[model samples]
Target: MKQGIHPDYHPVVFMDTTTGFKFLSGSTKSSQETVEWEDGNSYPLIRMEITSDSHPFYTGRQKFTQADGRVDRFNKKYGFTNKD
Candidate 1:
C-alpha cells in the first residue's frame, strides 16, 4: 500500500435521521460533525436519510403497486376488455 496516496480510513458513526439509529464502522468518508459514541469516544458523524432501520423493505412496510388497475388501463387503450 502506498503511504501518502491513500486516503485516511477511520471509525465513522452513521446516524439514521428518521430512526435515530447509530452504528460505528470504518470509512474513508470525512465529516465536519462529530458524535460521542457508546465507548465514550468521539468519531466523525455521518447523517443518512435512510438506513436498514428505516427502510421500507427491511422494516416489512413495502407498498404494493396497483398493477391490476394498470392492466385495465392498457387493455382499454387497445380497445380490449377482460373476458370474464
Candidate 2:
C-alpha cells in the first residue's frame, strides 16, 4: 500500500433512473451531482440505467422477443417453404 498513490475511497450513492431508487455504497468515483440522503448528509449521486431494483430479469418481469419474423425472413431468403 503506497501512500498518496491510491484513489480516494468515499461513500457514494447509486441512483437508478428507471426505478427512481437509490442506495448508499462506497466507491472511488466522484460526481458533481449531489443528493440529500435519509441520513441528512449530502453525497455524490451516480445515475444508472439498470439496477437490481428495476432489471427485468431480476424482477421476474420477462420481455418476449419475436423470433418468428426472423425465421420467416431466413426461410424466405433460402427459398424454404413452411410445408409443415
Identify the leading candidate in terms of TM-score. Answer: 2
Poorest 10 consecutive residues by lDDT, candidate 1: 62-71
lDDT of 2 by residue, 1-84 (tens): 789999999999999998899999999999999999999999999999989997887999854343577888899999999687
Please count the clashing residue pairs in each candidate, in the order shown: 0, 0
Candidate 2 segments whose C-alpha is farther than 4 A from its true place: 63-84
Model 1 agreement with the true structure over 1-84: per-residue lDDT tens digits? 667998888999999998899999999998999999999999999999999997888998853355577878899899996678
Clashing pairs in 2: none
lDDT (Cα, 0-100) at 74 in candidate 2: 91
